[model samples]
Target: MPRCIPIKEIKNTTEFARIVEESPEPVIVTRNGREAFAAMSIELLDAMRMERARAELYRLLDEAEEASRDGRVVDARDSIKRTRDRYGL
Candidate 1:
């Protein structure tokens, strides 16, 4: 389960930074007995971002494979030439 703390407990910048850096899981900050926000380590955020990017890459590859199987594909050399011309590269 996530660790939760009342918003009032975060009295200062030092405590807030300490909570975010030291918590193994996201720290759920509550206000008025209700969920307010979440704070987590930068490492955790970076890992989440990387995972999202990897998932997107896999999805794109799957789409490309499906398109290739359906013969909705272009020649690599021709595609590269078109890209280069389009970008004036």
Candidate 2:
């Protein structure tokens, strides 16, 4: 579960840094009982980013599969040729 910290707590930089470094879960900083921001380990951030990227990749692949099933795809060679011509490659 996420840990909620009041904005005032962050004033103690050493303690706040230690809390963030030691915890595996996200630390949610709140301002006046309202959520302000979140702090997490670099590893967690990278994992989240990778998860989002994979989700996007799967979504694109699904779209491609549906298009292929609908016979909306062109020949690979023709597509490559068009790209080459467009980019003067």
Candidate 3:
């Protein structure tokens, strides 16, 4: 479960920093009884970003595989030459 904190409690930067650093879960900041923001450690944020990126990469790979199976594929050498000619590379 996430740790919930009122916006008012954020005024104490030291305590807020400590909570974010020590807690394994994200700190949910509420405004007027509704969730408004989330605070998490840098490591957690980076890991989440990397995981999302990996998932996206896998999705793209799957899409490419389906395209290849459907005969909507290109030769790597031909594609590279076309790209080079288009870009004057």
Cα-based lDDT for every prediction: 0.93, 0.94, 0.96
lDDT of 3 by residue, 45-80 (tens): 988999999999999999999999999988999999
By the TM-score metric, which is better: model 1 or model 3? 3
Q: For candidate 2, write residues 1-88 as lDDT tens digits.
A: 8999999989999999889877788899999999999998887788889999999999999999999999999999999999999999
TM-score of each model, in listed order: 0.83, 0.85, 0.85
| Cα-based lDDT at residue 84, candidate 1 | 100
Q: Candidate 1, clashing residue pairs?
A: none
Worst 10 residues of 2 by lDDT: 39-48
> lDDT of model 3 at residue 83?
100
- Among all candidates shown, the one with the greatest lDDT: 3
Ranking by lDDT: 3, 2, 1
Q: Model 3: which ten-residue window has the lowest total lDDT?
A: 18-27
Ranking by TM-score: 3, 2, 1
As for lDDT, the candidate ahead, 1 or 3, is 3
